[model samples]
Target: MLVEDEHSLHAINVGRRLLVQLIETCKELENIHRIYAYVESTNLDGIHFYTMMGFQRRETLPDYFPQRASLTPDAVKLVYEIGNDSSTEAIQTFPVTNQP
Candidate 1:
C-alpha cells in the first residue's frame, strides 16, 4: 500500500520514513510480528528498493499474480520481521552515504 508517484523526487527517503512508521504502528497496535509484501518478479527496482529497506526475499510464488501474468510470470514474496532483536534495526541506524 505504500507507493509514491513515479514522477516525484525519490531521493528524500519519504517512503522509508513512512514504512518505518507503519511498521512501528503495526508492532504497537496490531501485535504484528512480521510484514509481508509481494512484488512482481519483473520489477527489479522494486525488489532492490525493498531489499535496501531491510526486507528479505523469501520465495517466488509461481503465477502468484494473475493480473500481472501478461507482464510478469511470477511474484516474489518478501518479509520484514519486527521485534526488539530483529535484524531490521540496521535499517534505522545504517548511515546514508549520500544526503539530498
Candidate 2:
C-alpha cells in the first residue's frame, strides 16, 4: 500500500516510472498479492502508467478529492492484482503501527 500526493510530483512520467520501479523492488523482497492506490481519476498519465504495468482499474469513488476536482480531476480507487505469492503487488492488510 502506498499513498502519494500528486501535487508534490506533478510530473506524471516520473510518478509512473517511480511506481514501476517500486513495485519491482518490492517484489524482489516478499510475496505481494495486490496493490492499492488512490489517484485522481482525471490523472490520465497515472492511469496510463498503471495500465502499462498490468494493473486493472478497480473502482471509482465519486467524491474522493473535492479540492482536486479542478486541480486534479480523476479521483478514483485503483487496484492492481498480480497473481499468487510471487505477485509483486504490495500487501495492504499488514497494519504496522507502533508496538513493543
Candidate 3:
C-alpha cells in the first residue's frame, strides 16, 4: 500500500482502507488462513501502520529484500491470522471509507 509523495493523502486513512479491503477479500477464500507482509526494517512507519492494522511481528528476516541499490537489505515479517474470533471483531471495527 504505497501512497504518493503528496502530503495531503498522508493522514486520510487511504492505506488502512485498502488494507481492510484486502483482508475482507482474503477472508472470503477458504485456503487463506493468514496474511503475511514483509516490511523493510528501516521503514518504521510502515511497520507501525501494519501493526496498527492488526498484523503481529512474527520474526526479523535477515537479507529478506534483494540486494538492490535502493532497497533495504533486512526486513521484518508480520502476520495477520484470519478465521478467528478476535480478528474478525477487530476487522469489523475499522471505519469504512467511501470510494471516490
- Please list all clashing residue pairs in model 1, or write none if there are none: none
CA lDDT, every prediction? 0.63, 0.56, 0.67
User: Whole-model lDDT for model 1 versus the true structure?
Assistant: 0.63
For candidate 3, the lDDT comes to 0.67
| Candidate 1 residue spans exceeding 4 A from truth | 2-5, 67-70, 84-100
- Model 2 alpha-carbon miss at residue 96, Å: 24
Q: What value does the lDDT take at residue 26 in candidate 3?
A: 72
Per-model TM against the reference: 0.69, 0.56, 0.72
Kindly give the number of clashing pairs for every candidate.
0, 4, 0
lDDT of 2 by residue, 3-55 (tens): 34445554556656766776776566657767766666666665665677776
lDDT of 2 at 31: 71
Q: What is the lDDT of residue 21 in candidate 3?
A: 90
Per-residue lDDT value at 72 in model 2: 49
lDDT of 3 by residue, 30-81 (tens): 6566777777787777778779999998898888777766667788888788
